[model samples]
Target: MKKLTKFKRIVTRIIVLTLVLSCAGGVMPSTFTPNAAELYSDKEKYISYNEETEMYEYSFYDAYVYDIDATPGQIMLDIIPSTGSNYYNYYYHKKILITWHSYNGENAAQYDYENQKLAESIQPESRINIKFAAKNKYDDLSYKDGYLGWESHKDFYVSQIISIRNSDEHIYGDINDDGIIDSFDVVTYQKYITDNLQYKLDETQFLNADIDLDTEITNEDCRQVIDFTLGSSKGFNGATNIGSIRIDNTVSQAMSLGVKNDIDFATAEIKFGVDVLKKCYDPEKNNTENILISPLSISSALAMTANGADGDTYEEMEKTLGNGLTLEQINEYMAYFISHLPDKDKEKVYLADSVWFKNDPTLKIYYEFLEKNRKFYNAEIYKSQFDETIIKDVNNWVNKNTKGKIPRLIDSFNIRSNTAMMLLNTLYFESEWQEPYIDTIDGTFTDLNGQKHLIKEMHSEEYQYFDLGNADAFKKPYLNGDYSFVGILPHEDVTFNEYVANLDGKELADGLREYADPETIRLCVMIPKFKYNYQKSLKDILTKIGMEKAFDPDNADFSNINDLSVEGALPLYIDDVLHKTKIEVTEKGTKASAATAVIMGMGAAPPEEKKTIVINLDRPFIYMIVDKNNVPLFIGAATQLSEN
Candidate 1:
């Protein structure tokens, strides 16, 4: 119960200011919309070249669709991507479902290609189609509806990239008008499940009975739907109403957002370190640093994996805990370690919505961390295939943990002969600065050249500024409430690479809060509007950054693992680390999206920068994500138009 520090207050104020500004940006994220006319109109062109046979080995439309739940003989991909002349490629055409998830949940999908029935309970294990769900962000398959194919045979070397339609803009199923998801108008949903009955309803009119989310049509379901339409309780059940996205209202106002995740630290390190901190600095309070600790969510993924049976899942894991142990006690044991070292300066995007299902974003580490602390005998490190089945469990775990708010983060994992493994990480934060900037009257921003960028300044009169003279990096800290918007704007004359190579200054980070000016200037700033994408495997970057020690098979030491015979069973290699970032600041406020996907065999995308002495956020520029210490976390360059 610590009082909010000045830094915490500032961050919170800034977040609220930025959200307000984001609302003012007049831009809304795009959603899914489908067109029947377009689906029937054009056929994608075919491109093919043969390298081995020295002639065209194969050619076809690279397009694909995803009707992930559709059953065999059901209305799978209606107009599957047309195959080329070889005729042999037809096998690749049909609604080929990727074989993934060993689904055992309540709504577990079943495919009876033999009886050609879908609504029936999945036999002990029946044959199925290819898996359509993407387990990790690194999965590159451009999959959709039922048809998934490669643009060129060379791309076949990589996983497919699922082409999910933006929102209602999905590739299929736009049959209803209620703005709610109805299955009737969908293409891949070919059947409806009822009590021991399966009905073939392919049109929008049949969607009235889809209540249980089993893609079904029942008289009882229709009655309930109609009752709600007429505002009557006869058919209305409010359970569905509760299953919506909820963002966290409390964005961290504190300097570090007080996020305490219990990771691989042994108990020897958890002994209260407050006494250790008191000796370092002199302050009014007994301790100089204020700390926050957040409890880790239940590890649903590993719970299911302990004995591998639902009836035995929780029971099996609990057996490891003493008979007297309650779920509550297990959680308390997991709260031991806090990030002792200061949190890196990360301007991370916070998800404000409350997690509903509360199980969707379950990280393996989240569960592993809990198990390590649980003191249960069953809580030992175990080897897993990291396959699609495991990936689905991971998704469900995350979905349940987030409480149904995070969407599109865990699509589905595919299990193919060539498919290897996946690692997924999801983070959420929301906080404002402690100090609110003064809402000024027509606050104008001026660039170094004295050019007025016509910036829609956040009308804040009260702001902290830096008087660092000619360096032009720190002039005015964009104050949104207590939070400060500082930029590592690169020199206009230098290429992004040169700027990064030359940027090794240690004291530059604190310059924003400490050495900056405290004046009200009519700052005329012009920031850009853009989203950038880059694709480069990370083996090169990590090696160059001297973190190669983490992945060296000969030297890698993951001895913390509780159950391994050897210290390092799994090779710690990063197949890819993609950094993606986007930034925009205006009078309305700021909205940015950035991420450094640490993919073992997978990933994408974030760090943003502002580079305009002229301050016109236009054209190309490179940016790096840094901790408050300004240590380069990830580097990125945004060129509106990509050449490489």
Candidate 2:
């Protein structure tokens, strides 16, 4: 008996070793054996591998054990069939048995010894034994004290158990689970369909190779897959296999309130604004009429609009506004420029932006576009019902932001039924002059048409940044030194149109910064107390630039903006851009506000050498409100004045 016990222990160790090594080598693992006596039958069973059938045949045994009525403990027999072996690593299918037994013996050591012996005989069937203790007297076993002392009670029984195994299946479309379906999959699928090579596939592979998702793979599916490989079509359907790009939205920060110290990278945007401003100048408009535009405001709203554009639509918009800078560069510079626009004490300049879209279920706008606008432009987003109420909502937003200066932006019924979204920017500025002047005295102001009108001009003599040459210019600072008002009086030799025609944004901004150095001498400054409003549709002007494709509904591509898969979806394109501005220059200060709406379907140096300069605005002259970075907040030609 002692020798048999030692042999059982050695055999159990060998089975454990085999299981551990087999699991690591992609082979069937061995099972454990229990040691309790009378738990398993000693009748020997044998299993042999059939090479011809690639299956394991096992010796059958009596399906039933004794149906002995026990006080508590009960034992039974069970067998199950196996069926999984795809191409990848897996376990072989076979029958397995589990036994539940309890010993009611005073010698616990003897119980273990007898079970170990019973375990050795059942090795051929791959049996595993697990022994556990009952938590309470009413649990698995019941105890009773024998005359010899305390003894374990056998009250355990086997219950119904389901054997489930890991699934062996291939990934759909990506047959090899490589995350992409390329030429390799196409070739394999073609070979399988042609039957040139005997290829076997499970249900998963069948679903994967069915390109059209029609439950079967036909020759047309093969041709479509080939086209997808060649990039002629996106995928089996109208979708692309690649996932959409994602934008991170976890970042948060307080908006800055001062101008950017450096304006080096801002040249591209500033230059573009200047170029657009020059192009907006019309030679045929009334000579007495004034033209005011906030290029920065317009560009900002459009920059936000560009977030949803893709392909040619994006490229043209970028090229029109970049002036050589990439989209990333433009976004960085504009975000910095707008967020840090010198809104210090007594300088009430507000640059606000908003985006409004219809809350339609069919239009699935990309979160990335929305996130980009929010992060870069501090854009306020709203989803409305594209009804008549949207007009009031938009106008209310504009009016509230502009402090009522802009009463209404969207007309009573200008919003078309198909309008998907609208992007808006508003700039409000009200600053007291650094050197307050009395009311303008009655003076003679000549218009560009050579017509002279009696005007009330404000007068002051203070140390100012002044330059005199081909064109006389001066910079008068407002409340804070962070902002200044620039006046450019075209020389009598050239018209205001001719002068601006030769100017570009970089040179204009550079000149504003370079020529604004304070002079030792104080020069007499006289400027008219004027108030005027300019409003116009910028569709033709924007088209004149290289952005004509954005207005072409047939050619524009705003796939990145909203989902194009909806039935009856109209192409997103820009209908028009409406801009309105009002400026009031008085003895106390200058109050100006401008709103620019980039309505989309879905869319310098100079310097120097001047000490004391004298300039009289007795004729037509150009002016601009510039920030510390020389950004033109408002650029206009003051041609007429009110007598009151």
lDDT of each: 0.28, 0.60
TM-score of each candidate? 0.35, 0.57
lDDT of 2 by residue, 1-644 (tens): 99996776466445434433554454432222222122323221122334543323333211111122221223222221211110111121122222233324344344345434443333212212222222122211211110111222322332211111112222345433234555555554555555542445544456566644334566555566555545566644332221211222332433333234356545655676666666767666745577788877888888788887788878998888777766666677767776665566447888888777777777777777777777777777777776777776777677777766675677845687667888899999988787665224678888767788887677676554545445767778897677878788877788777777777667665555554445555466678877777887888888888888778877777777776677645557887899988887866578888898877554200005655556777777888887766667888877766553
Q: How close is each model in CA RMSD to the real structure?
A: 26.8, 33.6
> In TM-score terms, which candidate is top?
2
The alpha-carbon lDDT assigned to residue 623 of candidate 2 equals 85
- Kindly provide the TM-score of model 2 when superposed on the true structure, using C-alpha atoms: 0.57
Candidate 1 differs from the real structure by a C-alpha RMSD in angstroms, to one decimal, of 26.8
**lDDT for 178 (candidate 1):** 29
Overall local distance difference test of candidate 1: 0.28
lDDT of 2: 0.60
Model 1 misplaced regions, further than 4 Å:
1-385, 395-425, 429-462, 465-471, 474-482, 491-497, 505-507, 510-515, 520-522, 529-537, 562-614, 621-637, 641-644
Q: Which candidate ranks first by lDDT, i.e. highest?
A: 2
What's the residue-level lDDT of 535 in candidate 2? 82
